[model samples]
Target: MKLTAISALVVLSKVISIAAHGGVTSWTVGGTTYPGWQPYMAPAGQKTAGRPYSSYDPILNPVAASLHCNNDGNNGPIPQSITIAAGSSITAHWAQWTHMEGPVTVYMASCGAPTCDSVRSSGLQWFKINEAGLLSGTVYKGSWANGQVLNSLEWTATIPASLRPGAYLIRFELLALHQANTPQFYPECANLIVTGSGNAFPSSSFLKPIPGAWTANDPGVLIDIYSEAAKSMTSYPIPGPPVWSECRTLKPLSERC
Candidate 1:
């Protein structure tokens, strides 16, 4: 009877953990909804036909950030691309997100090719557009969790108004720290074709390359959210290059840009 009770508790814990796994299933732009990355998809599988690659959970490697770029066994970018006007907002809708105490960021990179379908991560430069982390100096405020929007189902970010109009790849990442000791990463990417007259572009200081942009030991990536909460923590570090200054006017659940 005692052993059975212990096993039941263990099973319950596992169920809770599994319930927390999630990913952005689709995105909305200009009121049109598009399918998102396929978490755990095979390179040549039919299900991967038109979707970007991604992993649901249990895979956490920051050094191999490119896998999060388009996934699909690193095959290449998806054929279809989304079009958006400069300064407009895009919303990523997740299947579900159970753990809400960490950072969520949005980034963009120009597609080096005429089309993003064959674009690779090498030589690609990325710039931050938006980030959300540590809301109200606490992960939880009343009944809400930090960085959560649309009941934790969607996250919205605006494209830089002055961004150079061109083909770009947008990457969205969410770091789940509920199990802080082994933070989980949920990074996904989408193809985009910007159609506006904006001309500003990020300089060297504001851009970074994937695989080199993030490190496994980044303070924001490998943190202990559980332990930090007990110390009256008020600030949290967001990984990657600083968000473009001109795009800092909007607010997310973060402490600073």
Candidate 2:
């Protein structure tokens, strides 16, 4: 997410200079970096901070249509999609996280067609692929930037071997809660064509639409991480829909987990 001065109330006493924000610059599979989105390309009046950069002023409200593609309302999909086999591992290299923290999760939404190379993420069906929430302890467990990848640039996740073969959109989201009073959300989407299939795809029960998936008031998205840190909290409530169970649950998609 982009760190707009207006969205965050920086504690002057905390630090002298605050340069925070980041984006997945390149996608690497098996140690090879592939082409990907131009970080911070969607927002209006954004400066080119170089490859793998974070944006400022994240998509504020979860229901906002801008949530897709990091509000890259004007940009389309990348020219080529990264190719990987089911159950393969991929890593996103960040320019830098700039001391930011929070839960970083990867999601996949099947484009209407088998390939999402040229398709946008407007109405796709998305499900959680990998999620690293508050790992353990209270010091920084409940915060996004405090997760295992804190201050680090790269995050890796594996494609489910059970995923059906085809092209899909791999969306990455980082919810920066450093300024706990008002959280910032940074979401990016990339195109991918998966080979070597599986039988069980994410059922409708586990899928959700981007803009409609989260709300500003959701407990996970709207919490005071700083306050929790002060009290030595133990657990955190992750925002958005629940992780899909291998056994389908006949529940309405609109109902949040």
| Candidate maximizing TM-score | 1
Any idea what lDDT model 2 has? 0.65
Go through the candidates in order and give each one's C-alpha lDDT: 0.69, 0.65
Over the stretch 101-164, how does candidate 1's per-residue lDDT look in tens digits?
A: 7778888888766657676645588888988777665542322233475266888899988787
Q: For model 2, how does the per-residue alpha-carbon lDDT over 37-135 read when each residue is reduced to its tens digit?
A: 554357344322112223444656657776766653333422556788888988876665654456778888777675664465676778988777666
lDDT of 2 at 23: 61
Best by lDDT: 1
User: Where is model 2 poorest over a 10-residue stretch in terms of lDDT?
Assistant: 45-54
C-alpha RMSD between model 1 and the true structure: 6.4
TM-score, prediction 2: 0.76
- Mark the regions of model 2 whose C-alpha exceeds 4 Å error after superposition: 1-18, 40-57, 72-78, 139-147, 228-232, 245-257
Per-model tally of clashing residue pairs: 0, 14
- Indicate the residue-level lDDT of 251 in model 2: 37
| Candidate 1 Cα lDDT to native | 0.69
